[model samples]
Target: MSDKELTTKKYWEAYYKNSHVNKQHILTVCSYYSPIWEIFISNSEVSKSLIEIGGFPGRYLAYLANRYNIEPTCLDYNSDLTQIEGSFMEMDVQHYHIIKEDFIKFKPKLKYDYVMSNGFIEHFKNYDDILDLHVKYMSENGRLLVMIPNMKGYIQFYKYLVDYKNLKIHNLKCMKLKVFEDFAERHNLSILHLGYYGGFPLGIHQKINFLQKIIYKLHRLVFKYFANDKLKKYPSKYFSSAIVGVFEKQ
Candidate 1:
């Protein structure tokens, strides 16, 4: 499957249907969004306002609502998307230009302090389209936090070892900070802060508590024990399974 196909509503919806979008998943979204602080170092107060483009199940929305006394709106094409405690709505982000509906249509009246997303941009065939949308809706000096997958990670490299290497990861191509900086500049935005992390896919594993230590330990042990040593050429960290960037509209 190509990156475009993998990010389709059909694919994402199917995955959401299968996976548990529980508290652990919510924490994972918060973990990625929390890093936006690096973008606005001057802000003495904690984060308050935020907007999540692909706010599936409202996990990040919940996080923002619980943390700060602010409302976070979630927008997606899927009307069936889970609505949590925070503000929730369904609209095609890309086509908001046509309908002149949804939040973006009236964004001038409803600006935010920050804009955040996780594992959403790479799904698009091109980030340029999405970046423009983000730029239009983002407030001046408001921060944009984006998480793009870094395919060079061990998980992807290992697929080359197994037979599942056929899937193309085009999103990895634009994972560089340069790509983001270029986009931000084109839209008159600045790279206030940027970094790449997610070495071991540990971001998700961090959800497990000490009570689940035995389960996590056994799982790792099984892989280390039976896994091909040749496949383990990379260290525990692959450096770029995902890239997170925070930008401010200049």
Candidate 2:
């Protein structure tokens, strides 16, 4: 299938249905070690409202709601979001909403204080269209937080070695910080923070064979023992796990 077809609602629905649900909470994912968390905490204030675009099985959204006591909303094309809703409840997040609609057609009744998407926009061919939707739902001076896999670096090389098909689904060009900076400039959004984040992450987002699994494990060991702290402090575009941007509408 073409990249366009791969990013369609039908494709995503099927992908989510077939994939196992991640019951792991965001905190357990070592989020504090990454710059993404730092940017989030530094830019966010308590009691602000946030809407997560295309955030199905909203673990990250739940994390934000629980951590900051923020009202949260999750919007996605996926029909069954009971898992995500349950997560919110389990986390004791009282004020949260889940909208089962395509983000392209979603019209919010009120703009949110923050609009966010985790690994969402890179699936699209048109980065501006996806970003415009995020901007459309934000209140004036609201912040937009976007995080995408750093697929242009060694991660891309690793994916090419073991998960080329999965890599193809992502728009590698969108992973660049320049793309976001250009978008922010055109849209009159001030860049609060923009850079790569995290240590070398072991991306198991796709299925791999036995040998590939062993290699992945070895890589995880290497990163954990030697590279984690250094990379976390100075996340380079060549090896950092994600590219993150925090922008405020100006």
Number of the predicted model whose TM-score against the real structure is largest: 2
Q: In terms of lDDT, which candidate is strongest?
A: 2
* Candidate 2 accuracy as TM-score: 0.87
Question: In candidate 2, how many Å is residue 214 off?
Answer: 5.1
Every candidate's lDDT: 0.54, 0.78
How would you encode candidate 1's per-residue C-alpha lDDT over 1-250 as one tens digit per residue?
Answer: 3444335556556545643445656666566545454454344466456667776666656655555534566665544443332222221111111112233233444666777777776655766666667765576677787777665656555433331322353455565668787877787777766666533332231234474555446545655455424323432324335666778766
Candidate 1: where are CA atoms >4 Å away? 1-6, 18-21, 32-48, 83-109, 153-155, 162-170, 202-238
Candidate 2, residue 56: the lDDT equals 77
Candidate 2 backbone collisions, by pair? none
The sequence of per-residue lDDT tens digits that candidate 2 reaches over residues 79-115 is 8777677767666787788888777666778898888
What candidate 2 gets wrong by more than 4 Å, as runs, is: 1-5, 14-24, 33-38, 41-46, 210-214
